[model samples]
Target: MPAFQSTFDALIQSWKLRLQDAEAHETKLPARMETCIRVCEESLLELRQWVMEHSFPCRECEIYFFKQVKPVIKARYIYYQKIHRLHTGYFNGSGLLEKERLEKELRELAQYFTDNDQFFSYYRNGYTHHDELFFVRGQYDWKICPEVNHFDDLFSTSFDGKLAELMAYELLMKYVDGMLNPSCKLTEPATVTPSRSVAVSRLQCTASVTDIVELGYALHAKGFFNDGKASIRDVMTFLSTMLQKDLHYYSRLFFQIQERKSNVTKYLDELKAGLTRYIDQLDEQDQLK
Candidate 1:
């Protein structure tokens, strides 16, 4: 196991502790939600602290051990995936503009890490066998000096470190909601009753209400809702209000929801494509720098 293995292990252990505690005592929704938030927050803090403390060695060592040898890159990749999920989750529930913004950031971050990882790969041989004659000779080779090319500067700078606790917390909440709903894994309930009128023996917008309720059930079936316990009445009421304000809202919401439930391979391909572009950009920058 590598150094990062231990760091991730520690993180997992801490999470397990939180999870255990939460499961044991958090029987209510409020308590469960709080515990889930805490679990996410504490894990994020632990990772942030670890990166700040061990950023140097991880970067330096990984250059030689390319092909995902070090923990830092793997760590970043893992966090990136988590963050992407959160972003997607949020996007699924948000307005179009918000979803677009998150998608942009997701792509940019993916590209940034990909570029950095490729940059490290360039000096892999020299860094890997530092004691070898060829490696030593390469060290003083000014033409390829990393410092002159700002490799050190670029490498030392952690772009992803800019991730904020507030942002992470929001994203994690979205993820937690998705996880608990279980709708993501199973079909939504077949029928959910809407509130019926008890007075005047009259109903209002019954067809519209029924349609909205059906849509909610469909969305829930598609694993759109974050809260599993959110009653049909709750979903129907929320949708009724929103739809009354804007009939086109569901169309937008459904698009994002579909994206959240998009094929996993789609995301994997995006990451791969971003990294490939990053390598090309790194090569261009190397020449310019």
Candidate 2:
């Protein structure tokens, strides 16, 4: 689940009751949504502190291994934080432009992670809106599971047997598995050079905006996920840099993937056609000016 908290106390209690009365779960209430988060947070804090204090490593009979894996573990912490934040936002509000803005961020983040949509920005979007509804195309175990006989029964049942799990959840779980096992594969990241050469030779002005963005994503996704440097200082640096930058040029050249049609590839096509027509008409008007 792309949920911020791994398990809420209410969620856990719900699971317990689900095992007790699977059908009556709709009526089974939780203390509060935050209960689970608070529990998860305290548990994780203890666990991380233990790891840090004892330096426990899953592999290698040495504490040195924990040092190497510390980054990965820390990432899970951040992932949980993001999940909680979005979970709160959904119940509360993320402001007016947050959804669209975060959607764009997630799509771009997907490029870096190369379709690892679970931790991607849009994953946050889903958590913050529509009660964090995620849409999945396939029956991936982690992303989509259907509620069936019982939540407890799922451990014994094959993934195919469950229908209550959301498809998005299953897929997102697959992404998480990829993070863990890395047999978990994602697409390669890509980029658009914004040069005329590729436009003329490859895309031929007919390439769709989705195609261009996909290409860029494919290029960029090949790289590793960069969850570092996102602290307050880094955020301040980014904002300061952004304030000095040109949004119009960047928006036209890059940052408009949400619409798919605002990509430079689309702009080039319209501009080319319009310029050709304008030049032709201007030549006819040469009779006057």
Whole-model Cα lDDT of every candidate shown, in order: 0.43, 0.35
With candidate 2 superimposed using the best TM-score fit, by how many Å does residue 104's alpha carbon deviate from the native? Answer: 5.1
TM-score of 1: 0.28
Report the Cα lDDT for residue 166, model 1. Answer: 19
> Model 2: per-residue lDDT, tens digit, 1-289?
2132232334435443533452243342232323433444554454445435653232222212222222223333344444445434544253322445444444444443433334333332433331112221121344344333222221222221222122323333333323322232233435546684456355323445444433334333443224331222222223234233212111122334544554545544665788999999999899777
How high is each candidate's TM-score?
A: 0.28, 0.25
Best by TM-score: 1
Native-referenced Cα lDDT, model 2: 0.35
- Model 1: residues with Cα > 4 Å off, grouped in runs: 48-55, 60-289
Roughly what TM-score does model 2 have, to 2 decimal places?
Answer: 0.25
Residue 99 Cα positional deviation in candidate 2, in Å, after optimal superposition: 3.4
User: lDDT score, residue 245, model 1?
Assistant: 30
Candidate 2, superposed: residue stretches over 4 Å from native: 1-33, 48-76, 87-98, 104-263, 266-289
Task: Report how far residue 255 has shifted in candidate 1, in Å.
Answer: 0.9
